[model samples]
Target: MFTIPSPTIVNTSSRPLSETTIVRRKTRPVRVGHVTIGGGHPVVVQSMINEDTLDVEGSVAAIIRLHKIGCEIVRVTVPSLAHAKALSEIKQKLVETYLAVPLAADVHHNGMKIALEVAKYVEKVRINPGLYVFEKPKPNRTEYTHAEFDDIGEKIRETLEPLVVSLRDQGKAMRIGVNHGSLAERMLFTYGDTPEGMVESALEFIRICESLDFRNLVISLKASRVPVMLTAYRLMVQRMNELGMDYPLHLGVTEAGDGEYGRIKSTAGIGTLLADGIGDTIRVSLTEAPEKEIPVCYSILQALGLRKTMVEYVACPSCGRTLFNLEEVLHKVREATKHLTGLDIAVMGCIVNGPGEMADADYGYVGKQPGYISLYRGKEEIKKVPESQGVEELINLIKADDRWVDP
Candidate 1:
């Protein structure tokens, strides 16, 4: 049988066997307007507005709405030159009417001219490497020769140079955003429809930007499938490490459909990398309103202990030993203290395991008897109150500690 070690016999000078903290990867900071990504900054939350860029009023209002509710960076699609020009008006209006929110422009399909124009207005320009210098795929071609591959590569460089130079001179950032569904034909021919293709496509663009001495860059390799998305980002990080590159990564699972499954799918992929210390900025791409994506992003960050924007509640599942209605009482307790940010409050159904299980909480509401509930402050039993008065007493306890804030 395994034996437990005695505390008196344990070495006092030795470090703890393990730590719960996550050690983040080292990466240089890339600024998106006033917000920073990587370089030990807290993970950033982002969402894209679905409004058309040409509708400047609607787009500006949407950007302001998203920004007011914790979206640090807002993205809009620019499909043509007119839409790109519309951003200039949208930006000016935001400054005049609301705040100068950080903006990113999404450009695709041979968008060199459009990107250059939009780059003048936005803080960052995001380009899909596969579509930026689009080439209609030759249906009969099976493979690419070295000469043909290099020839198209040179074309990409020429087309991308002007926009790179514009963003560089303007002191702005660019995202080498690659999607699995739209990888370049040459990359598809060489690397097949694999994660390798996604990484190579992003790298080709990163190299072009680097060759121009422009490094204000962020990289993303997003795939709709969770496994493919996970693999692509891991491979990208591995390749970047091998090449001594420290560009920040933007993480997401593309086309994660609406409702519970979408949130779960995104969290499964994005949260896995974050736990491994990989991602810098994240967007939960849900099919719901852009506002819904913000909460999901913050929830993921809060659950991981990386950011705390709301109260953390700890409740025990009701059992036969439970002294009260756990579900109902938990709801009441939460409603009362929901606005107490940065505080951990526990709601235990019984005293048998309550004090021990909720030992780490800042404040605890635990059942002590059939008609009474005990209030605790970090494992110390402060008082026992009638069940009807438990939540109010807990609030009183917080007020006594001077931690209660009026909601």
Candidate 2:
């Protein structure tokens, strides 16, 4: 890949069959277990295990759950030697069993031990500058002078940098998952509480690691706030460009809450960056089981038009024109087809809007009589399916056509 891209001249056919102006950032590949992360991997979706590490079976069980939901990479917290010891067994179970998803070990504070124990078995290790600190503000902390915060920040990097050098020496795939909330206070003080400040803090670590000749690197900058997360990444990308760095970017919104709100917030942050072609991998952090992360991550990727597979569900918001109990039918269809595994299906209220709405679906349904729907496979009606059986019939038709997914 070239450091600077050649200028684009669009061939004139009147419409775009290819993205003419999109310049993909040059990146080297970084593999995590069976899956690839950076350097043009297909924007993989990942999640982490939230189970107790001591229970190896339970931890593997959590990984299995994430795998079933289409998670490509799953991370586990290895805070102690016990958790570190379990990684080899956990990896053995994953490769031998069905969930061959790659494993990442989250190592904080105790960097040298984490490196010593997990460097061999795990595919990736997460290093955070903030993890070295106790994360406390002492009494009258709000009134602390600038120097105290600066010292706190400096002390953290001093605790963490040796591990970056050690991991580099050990030749391990390392991901620097930077925390926006715990950014070095000195950087924050110098650059203010802005996205530039966040990027400056992260780039510091990247520079340190790069100085050690560690080329196998992935970077993430996560914030609980959506705008902060977005702008920080934009600024980081800009900075990386200026420095000629092409590390794979990990897209995420940390601590996003649960269910609809969480999904939306994650979409708003991670989704925006992805849509702009800036993300290479994604993790949607919710304070829930890792299983929930997989589906949401897949959905976001699907929405971005990056991954194609079994089914795509498109439903209309109920309106005056809607008939045949649209909302009820939509819920049933969505629930039934959730496991389609790259399946594309759309459910709509009436042909008054459904056909135009679902022009892209592999199989779709629009309102007919009170108990029927207009069944469609790419503009041609195969039959009028009974509304009660619409969900099952559509899924079966997809299965028959694709011959790829397990029904």
Candidate 3:
């Protein structure tokens, strides 16, 4: 057997662990729902349920499931007056049920009534800036001039301003959610399609909001393309520093695909920003159901050392000396431990190589015979367990010992 360094990281024992090597971007704290953003909190995970706005029970159940899967915040689309009403019921249910996380209401209107109605219930009101009801605009005026375009934007801001004030006054949080696809056409026409243009447009509105004396805000500059999304956020972060504004950032790669491509796009865009300490909260916006996002979000945070709870698994790819069906066995072990948060388990093959791979593991299965397996933890053989009971035995061992618990 061959020897190699283990990929599984050691637990925090305060035993001379390596210091965080990267420099983090410092930003002020913002409260979104019950979770705190910025000011050194663990990076939060969020998911949006694309369900009926008035379906209060459906939305509440969806959010409860999201919470169980470690989603810190849940954003629901409030497309109309009815959906806004649902938010009121949803928020009341959340309070009565004793689920403490905050709700976010997403509104794409150019008006404030919806924002105001949901503001009382939601922790954050996500406003996708637009001229009030621009999607369903009035008939074209007799010879629309350039001022018409500019007027539409200003008018939209005007509609949003009072609502923004109401939200601030009523203690509702807000996120300036900008989409690369729907960048105000006039701004796109003026600056052309570029990262600087997108960020400039976002900051332009941000400044407009700031001029109103509102500071409790977060910002999102999302692009479907990973590089464009990365570029936009980096530029926005740089400008936020230049202006000394301290709003927590919300990060995502918008419309990131399903399964592998979506995962790759999100990882590339979100991962790049996170590695530089630029993002405060993250979302894996896949084309699939919201539940698919939870594990991916946690994995990204784990890779960046931004999250604490996890089961770090280390196993060797089958390479001949790997006795037994290590592949299938490792899969079983990993599958079993998905629900076991905050424990580190290692399933490896070969007595000679497996111990080194599991040197940092809390409980390990090194190699197996036809019926039994060799077990070790911290360089000592503990006991042998049947192959059938291996995964459960490992789990029971972890829960019994406090070694894997966060220090």
TM-scores, one per candidate: 0.95, 0.80, 0.83
Candidate lDDT values, in order: 0.91, 0.74, 0.76
* Candidate ranking (TM-score, best to worst): 1, 3, 2
> Which 10-residue span in candidate 3 carries the lowest summed lDDT?
6-15
Report the Cα RMSD per candidate. 7.9, 6.8, 8.8
- On TM-score, the candidate that comes out on top is 1
- What are the per-residue Cα lDDT tens digits for candidate 3 across 1-407? 12222222222112233556444567778877568887778788999887786887888888888988899989899878888988878878877885856788888855478887878788888887533345443354233357776676677677778877887787667888888887655555555566666677677668777888877788898899987887778778777767878788899999998999999899999988887778888899999999999889999888776785677777877777776688898888877676566556778777877777788777788775557787777677887888777777776676567543322
Q: For model 2, what is the alpha-carbon lDDT of residue 227?
A: 84
Model 3 reaches what TM-score against the true structure?
Answer: 0.83
Instruction: Write one digit per residue (lDDT tens) for candidate 2, span 38-64.
Output: 676788888888887778899888888
lDDT of candidate 1 over 1-407, digit per residue (tens): 12222112112112234757766778889988899988989999999999999999999999999999999999999999999999999999999999889999999999999998999999999999999988888878877899989999999999999999999998899999999999988887777788888988999999999999999999999999998998888888778877999999999999999999999999999998887777899999999999999999988999888899998899998999999999999999999999888999999988888999999999999988899999999989999999999999999999999999999
Any idea what lDDT model 3 has?
Answer: 0.76
Model 2 scores a C-alpha lDDT of 0.74
